[model samples]
Target chain A: MLDVTKAKIIHDFAHDRPLLACRYDPKERFVVTSSEDYRLQKFSLPGGEKTILPEAHNSWVHALGLSPDGQILYSGGCDGKLVFWNIADAEVKPLRTLDAHQGWLRTLSVSPDGSLVATGGNDKTVKVWNTQTGELVKQWQGHAKNVYSVQFMPDGKRILSGDLGGAVQLRSLDADDIKGNFEAKPLHTYEGGQMVDFGGVRCLAVRPSSDQFAAGGLHKATNPLGAVHEPLALRFAFEGNQLLKSHVSEGITGGGLWRVQWLSDGTLMGVSGGSSGGFLIFWNDQQDKDFSKFKLPALARDMDLSTNGLNVVTAHHDGHVRITRLSES
Target chain B: MKCPYACGSTEHLMARRKFLSLSASGAVGVAGGLGLLTRGAAAEQVQQKQQRIVVFNMHGGLSQLESWDPKPGTRTGGPFRAIPTSVPGLHISELLPYTAQQMHHLCLFRGVNTSEDDHGKGAYMMMTGRRQTPAADYPEIGAVAAKTLMPEDSSLPGHIRVVPHGGGGRGSDAAYLGPKYSSIHLGNGNPPQYTKRPDGITDEAERRRQEFRRKSDRRFLDGRRTAMTDVFTYSFEQADRLMEQRDVFDVTKEPTQDQEKYGTHDFGRHCLLARRLIERGISFVQVSHSNYDTHNENFDFHLEQVGEFDRPFATFVADLAERGLLDQTLIVVLSEFGRTPNINLYLGRDHWSKAWSVLAGGAKLARGAVLGATNAEGTEVVDIQVDHAQLFHTYLQAVGVDTSASFQIDGRELPIADPSAEPIWTAIA
Candidate 1:
């Protein structure tokens, strides 16, 4: 079980601007964060040593994806530019920058083999890039609105993309025999909730076994303007893209889940907050109820879990990177 | 005298004289004679090319940082950036890219100090140009324009409000100016009820029915001379005039290309209708865009709301300019107030009134002009602060109304604007 009764903040690092995206190095020795100040910084875990890479993007850097080998990182910003970074050096170095999208890039996902990087953007297109060569591999146009999140299934031949209209589509990455060229075919689609018109799926997590995936976002807008709704986390069986279950934090007043992740032991976690406050909630497969939850000082924009699953770090709108510890089973 | 409708027949004049004789009374006799005299006066007013006003009321407070005045890169600026407009140094939020292209036609006021924060009170103050008082009711700007600028023989109601979602708050009434100047509220892109003749009724039959009803109503109203009775009598006459030219409210009369340019959303259609009404010589047209409260998820909701607003508004302005109405029509974009500059814990902004922004253009108002300034954090006005009364006076002046005039309400002279306030002269030509 996930225990938050003994949860404690391990470290808190401040940046010049709100940190929007974060990723943990494969060895778990460092954490790289992107911020609205257009800078990316690397912080050494435990020691808290910070190295800032100036001018990382022309505008707010919103999405960060790290290679499986931890040797390279990809950053996408509102300037519509996507850049590849070589993080093996003492300082992060830009390998190449590609004018990827026509609008703000919201989410990025790397294939399991690290050969392809999938990007979702405000242009309403899902684009795959050759990570090493910095070339455009494929682009799929199916989302009716801004594409918010994309993820590669563990099998690495299929992708899941979500949009502002709350549509989740499973697409094939391989070329069809009749087409003779790589064209993403929509395999399945899941409509999140009646409130899908109010918001889109913001974060998606595929299980380690690739048999199930969870999508998180707001379930409804209580008012016409404010997104004061229940933060919803839906778990779906991959076989048919069937919705198996849904979870929400009881008594939580306001906010929508901005990020979701599945722990190695199958604990599903969601981070969300709005004007009332922020929350970090965890749910296990055995029950629909949240097993544990911790409140944060500010809204958590994004989060990354360490490989061992003992530590989870969150980037916040208040310019603080909060590190918290989970009880070991 | 020539008939206003130019039907080249004396039948309309005979009908007017007959209606006047039926309702003639000691109290209404003077009003009837003055009304006839004003018809000639109205021709003179029209000869001067009477200016018109269109108030785009953003019902709930819109965020100044997201629309007119942006403090990008600040802690409270959210994720959107500020982009340069056609004006050299003026910058507005990137969310309004389409409006930005039309900046040369707009004058932005970023330093407004409306002290009331509550929705009802703020709306009252902004609409009536005066603080709430227990002594007397105040006239809204639309009502004032209806009384002061509309041609006496206008077939359409001078003051009209197109409320799509619903009414925002109080203060749309004519108050002391009486119900005759009150706004004619229309539903979401639909014509006012009873406008169309019933399926089985012929035009001549309908006219005969109206004449019979008017004769009975005049008899019933002969001794009952109250404000309520006057309002009822006025409504009947207005409805009769409206039936003759109801096509002005038919937005479908516009071509498909024009409709597509304004977009298909309710707000867009309302704007297109506002343009049509203005073209038909409406004195004041208030089109309200609802639900900008945005107490949480400010940036996300703004992207949706502003994205929907930008294209239609920009297109409307451009169309007005292309049709040569820009010089004679005054366009006002306003809200009750603005949202707080402090980004709340919910990632939203609460209601704020101390410092905000409003956009005005046309009627020879200074173009490409940005007046006033807010502090670095947008928490307070730093330069040339304008209050609700001053802004209202400026609007009146832009539309060629005498801001210094007063209305004789209940035997007391009430100033059109706040007595102590002056127009923002720098904003007007």
Candidate 2:
């Protein structure tokens, strides 16, 4: 089991601005990050050497995906363009670029076998593309609002997407119709006083050892524009899209967790930000509250767990890409 | 590209020619445009008889990056996309698609740098067209319009403000403009509070009471009459007349189809009421849609708040145009200031007064014109930059009011708009 009490920060790589997304190289060579400055950068694992890539996006890049074989990387940006990069290229430049959406592209997920990539956008669309050719395999526009999160299921035959209205729709690769929809209503709010709908499914994680998944967001938005709310995560059964448990905690006051991941030991981890500062909270399926937690240096926008499950990397607004060792020093 | 629809109409061309001809002549000079109001009474009469203005105050700081001056594909543009409008190449954020369809009737004045980031100060500058100074207090445009456009025989109060969520009261924003032109707040689509007569008093009883009060007022003021007393009497009579026609403020009486078209939200109802007042011949109507401060979750709130704002605003404009009020009415969409171009750590934008946009339309103003430009990243205005004073002059000038002229008040000649800034000439018809 992952021991939250033993986790300690081993490295804090400072950058110029807030980082939005972070991912570990499959070969354990480096860690990649996209940030508020619209730059994609890589930090070497041991030495913490930094390499800033050439300009590939004119806007903030929010989603990054590495192929299973670890040779290719795909980045989706608020500019709605998706760019492909060869990881081993001495001169790091875009290999191919596609104008993938009508508006901001928010999230992208590489399929289990790395044959396809699924992406979501502010255009209320979920699109699947052939990874090798960068050809759009199929595109669907069914969300009532902006699509904030999307993920390819472990089976590779299905995909799930979440929207601004807190709707999680399940779909099949072979069909155009929706297989099912799980309404994560607690993760959404239509604040009448402000006449605004705030909060959405911000992040999603699939349990590695079980047929279950979790969606992370915020609720109780008494004042959404003011950033008043609490963090909420819902665990669901993958078989019928049944909601099984709701994980919540106290003393948030404001802000929410936007990134989540499943740990090797079946613990669920989420990185939160906003007025509540930054925190990493862990939960188990049997409990309705977090089992353990650790505070972050500042607000964390995104987080990732390495394949080896020993290092936890968090992207923070303090301009630090922090690496936390999960085991004893 | 210049909009084809606004300029192509045969009647519009004739009007445009007449407008242009007048704009060049000494007989139709605006105060700020031609340096002085030398046209005498002909222009003053036209200004009094023809002009109307509706102001939409997007309370709190609205995000220019998400509304008028979208920099989609840029780092600071957030996650919204900019979409094309009816005005050919002019585009706004997708959050305002409904408003985009009405863009042909409006001009995007994209280069506004008011330079006042504080809420109270910025609001004062935008509304009165002057910097806030301890030495001077200026009336907002609404009060100015109400006083300037008052018909000789009309008892109806010309200034009205519609807010759907607050308690109604008479506003004191008139400043030096006097209480006679102050705004009567219409709260929550309900008519001015206490417009209805008490059950205990019949019409005859009310008439008798009013007659007695007027007689007492005349007798008491006969020896000690003052300017303040006259102002009070005039305001009371206006209020009495409004009570008789109070049903006009009840928006539920509007057609169900009309109500549905504007949406059922608070902002929507307020917009409907604004249109109703405009159609009722009120010279100045201000409707506010608010809570756009957006210190966090900027995208989500804008997606919702701007969405709520879009349909109602468009419907108000289209309905006025359909009713032939567009020719005489000036519509202004304004805010205290705009949110920053920088996307902060909370995914929110801070106060940015350096560069932004304001939407102006109708009256005799130029249609389908883009008055200014912001660079690709929207960090600054790259062309035709104008400030609040210039905008104030432009709005007054659009209604044929000479911004250079002074209002003769209490033996003092107070200049109407700021003398330091002139109207935006390119925005005029």
Candidate 3:
């Protein structure tokens, strides 16, 4: 159902500063992005009209999510604040802002029903909040390091959070923390030479209509201080929480895989950034190596797919949000 | 000869060769009474200037935005937040929670513009307080302090560098002041080999052998007491004294709580050893905590590095203050330069010398003081800009050395510091 080999850049919305992530409105009318410039950017679809959203967070905002109806956009920032905006408004502003975490709120995942939002960050905690009232509903702790990636299971009954040390834990919505653990040790590297702990779980994705999920990160850090590392991904079976396969690059010198997603046909797509620049890699379920790959003009920090399964948006370090058409019209 | 309880590592072998060489006599023998004429006249009376100096050399370019002068909430501020310190109105990066409580004993010079970006040249400027010119070379601060403050009766080497890597050896940074004042590199804070008699050699036998050697040397030198023989004798006598004080190198001798206060990691152990050496009256101790050149993932690396550096460094400062040593010691924390405020593509900060900060305390420095100021974005100094020359003068003057005085060397009088620059008077009590 997906043909990544035929992908081509459809448009580029320049922001003039490094961007971290982008998300398309399910309605396909506009797209919003978060960047290191400490603000959010909106670009109207087809017309490519660029608009600067009202400054909601005091620091670089990196995480974004949208309601199922695409009316409410939730953004999280390094300032530890989470804010909501009415995406349908002509002049959108922060409808409500909540102090979500202690510091550097890094990742957020919205429930399939669009009622709850889960967040994780440098504070080493996972939090869930009510989207309507902006009230914190639950707080999960046990991570020894920064929490970098978070996601809600499609069933809406559980959530998964990953940390800088590459530990992935699955938690349930009804009871206490930590339902199960998945092995992802290949992504952790404690560099003794510089006394730096390198690598982290960067992104997570679950296959539609299946019982498997994947986490992307870095492995075999050669020179961590210089960011010399290789990209890696692990797919796990939901039955025993056992690892199924470890996806790796051919020979790309990189920092790590920043974001990953499962296609309609269960094909895995990953975006890599680092010394060799950025690349889009496509992989099959049964193999550890990529089946095909595409090169990007610059390193990408985050990636999001359009609802139609034909288009994808990537946040680039070269100060542009590029929309790539993954299939020929 | 080996340390009586030696581990027999090849490092000890290299150390023995370096420390026992004739050139190293000047490095180990600050108490060589015959060498006093080559010292700085301004500080000739070491008894009156029993002052000490300690430097925490943060190697590589430490990002000012993530440490001393945080510009949080600004475009160039990066991710980490700035938290309040012990001193009222003083704030530093949140990465240094342990160090925040010890800020009362510290002062910051925020508007430093050394203008050198290369690592080697910037390090030379910071440690030696002068630009690297082709015509002239200068000694590091450790060498200067050793020659100026080491008492004639002191038994230990005056200048010591506790490095976490490499083997024990002597540095060659004394420049025109001669090799005798060079800093001794104590790898992992351990002294060189031969610090103890072998298992079979009794003390009485050792004393008798030493006496016999002295007698033989006296007879041979009756007509040939030359510079070479004098240097050799000085080296031998000092080596014996160091062996007697080898117990100071064993950090495990400290209280369990004290060792635990500083983490048991390599940097912590090295810092503890530096403390012992200073408490034992060493004139200058340099502790290196390195590899801060974060060209990628600067925030993550700082979180690890600055977090590791926070507790032990603060504990050391607090201990010095409680022991009354703060009144006589000049302590400083510095690096080659500061990182750029502009975040790069990889979220890394590049080498930036336009505006940075340095931390200093102890001796005559005003406690809880902040000197100079950076603009809101930290791109430039808005007030009280000072360079390395001024910083060098501040260091020596804080320890009671007269900045206007000169050191007499081979019939030539060299000014102790750059004559064109002066210390930030406001920072001095």
Candidate 4:
């Protein structure tokens, strides 16, 4: 039997604004949380003391991305600049800041090889920057709406970017013209909007080794039966080509499904809200259709599956980190 | 090799002249000739053809009873009257006076039946002319037309779909053709976005940049002339030229009279653009019109929609005929399915896939006629049954495509059109 069980929160720390997103380092030694309170916190593993980076950003840090090598951290806020942090250095100062985006940056995705970082913003553009040189190498300029999330393929050959229009556009980075203003032509586009019946893609995450990925967000629909249809959905895409399946969760009344992440082991994780209140759910693909959902205890603002696959963590709206393990039979 | 069916008709003969003119107008590079020569082989099946297909996808389910199959003076017939069209005895909804006036130029299929009521699945069935698959999705008709009919040498896109898939959260999409054949969506219909060049890039500067890129691409290709050799090379060259003429999407440069005739509505303007694209030798263009889902106030809603649709559709058909392009341009008006014959208490129509309607005009469709008919209540097809498969077969046949043709997929020999379907000869020229 396969099951997921969330443990009790070890430490509780509250923030004025909700914790919008969270991430873990490759080694699982540290956890990072970005909040709408305009602050980022770096916490030691297994619920130790946390160090808040109060001077990190000016506005709400809506997005956070870690380089594949775990050497650098990229964060974007409502202020529209992508700040890169050198993870190895004791002094946490932004190594570089990209201010070319016209609107608030919504997502940041680092290539698996740690060579490229793709940033999508509310300006309806996705721009790729060379991690080492900070040069804008490619720009995807076609989406008519704000972009929400971006994920690079495991092999670093291609990348996927999602927009507010519910499109998952796969863009290829030209190898020959590394700095020659490579145009991002979409290789695949998913109607993430249709799958969830939602407004658009709120978040997306690619699996570690496979082309399979997950997209999660809120959905809204007008039912002919006089009932409105609303739900949170995890749409799975295989080979970055098409959406294979969709798992619907309870809908949020006011807030929506804000974050979605996949572990190296291919388990999906995300936050959802309902009448019973907000909860974190771990999706085990191996679960039978009848028994698929496992809700966490607290109101998780965001959640992440560890790269090591041994632990799962949740960033609570109450400002606490809940670390838990999966109990498999 | 010449197409065996080529009788040097006005269409085929005129197409040849236009093709020659287009090739000559862009004769700056020797590469252009090579692209055209290679394009010759890929398009051998289509001959030296320049046919266009404009698909007006009426998103949401349009009711056959309310629009095309009116049961006038019957209980099922809502509060609406049938108006006589320009073609004697042919009548359509009073709501569509404009379309009625131009009815001589249109053809209606009123007996279409399907099993899928879900918007997503129905859309897939309509676009691909096949049932939805659990494993492998199929390419849409536009994608297939782009593959089979579009000239590989054309500088414009072979298939252009201006609306986002399925018209905003309706689950409409290009299923299996992969992203390569996906549409360059013109974003929302609110105000066409993504149609402008970046600021600070002067025309001279832009041309210089393109020239530089071309030089760089040429030098790069010359260095690996032996390594990278295949149909991809030809595709890339065509894509390069398409990038140059990207401004073809702009409607601002069109004549004031023409733009005004197309109207200021998004759908109307998009229809004009679709015609413009087809004129430029594009094989397929889909213009999506939205908000046809009339779950409430059915009669009132359809009245408004048909009102908006009437003038533009008539104007488009007239414009096509005026340009002498109607004979070679197939205009298809399609939707997912029809609404319920019985109006609900909310004065609404629910989803019904049993019987509906689709309109075909231009190309070889018999003009000034309505094919097939529904029962008295407009609830089911009682005369000349035209299922979705047969409708698709008739459409392909009217466009000069062989409906009986077959293709191999996963080791199985599959007919392109449904095997059980027979093309409706009455609807085809």
In terms of TM-score, the best-performing candidate is 1
Kindly list the per-residue Cα lDDT of model 3 for residues A70-137, writing each as its tens digit.
Answer: 89999998889999999867989999999999878999999999999999998999999999898888
Model 1 chain B: lowest-lDDT 10 consecutive positions:
B1-10
Model 4 per-residue lDDT tens digits across residues B13-52: 4433443454347553323333232222223445456777
- Which lDDT values do the candidates have, in the order given? 0.77, 0.81, 0.84, 0.64
Residue-by-residue lDDT tens digits, candidate 2, B1-429: 222212334433443344335534735421111111111232363454557899999888788888999987666777677789999989899889889999988878999999999999999999999999999889899988876664434556778888757678899888765666678898776788778888999999989987797678668656654435545555655667777888888888889999999989788888888888777777899988877888886876787678889999999888987888888999999998998888777888878888999999999888888888888888899999999999999998888788888764433567888998999988999
In candidate 2 the C-alpha lDDT for residue A123 amounts to 87
Question: What is every candidate's C-alpha DockQ against the true complex, given to 2 decimals?
Answer: 0.34, 0.35, 0.59, 0.01
Candidates in order, TM-scores: namely 0.89, 0.80, 0.89, 0.49
Evaluated with lDDT, which candidate comes out highest?
Answer: 3
Model 4 stretches astray by more than 4 angstroms: A1-329, B1-49, B164-180, B188-196, B201-243, B406-415
Candidate 1 to truth, TM = 0.89
Worst 10 residues of 3 chain B by lDDT: B1-10
lDDT string for model 4 (A1-329, tens) is 22445333344544444455787787776778875356687776654656776465555576787887667888887567788887534555678877847646878888878888888987888888988888999887767667777777777877777765566666678732222111111211222322111235666777775556766665443331221323354545453355455655533342245566664546676665432345555565654121244455545556666675656667765556666565442
Model 3 lDDT tens row, B247-349: 8777889888899988898789878888888888889999999778898888878877888899999989999999998988889999999999988878888
TM-score, B chain, candidate 3? 0.89
Query: What is the per-residue lDDT of model 1 for residues B362-421, given as tens digits with 9 covering 90 to 100?
Result: 986899899999999899999999989999999888877767866544334567788799
DockQ of model 4, rounded to 2 decimals: 0.01
Error of 4 at A92 (Å): 91
Per-residue C-alpha lDDT of model 2 across residues A19-103, encoded as one tens digit per residue: 8889887777778898776689888877888889888886778999888767788999878999999865556788999999876
lDDT measured at residue B280 in model 3 versus the true structure, 0 to 100:
88
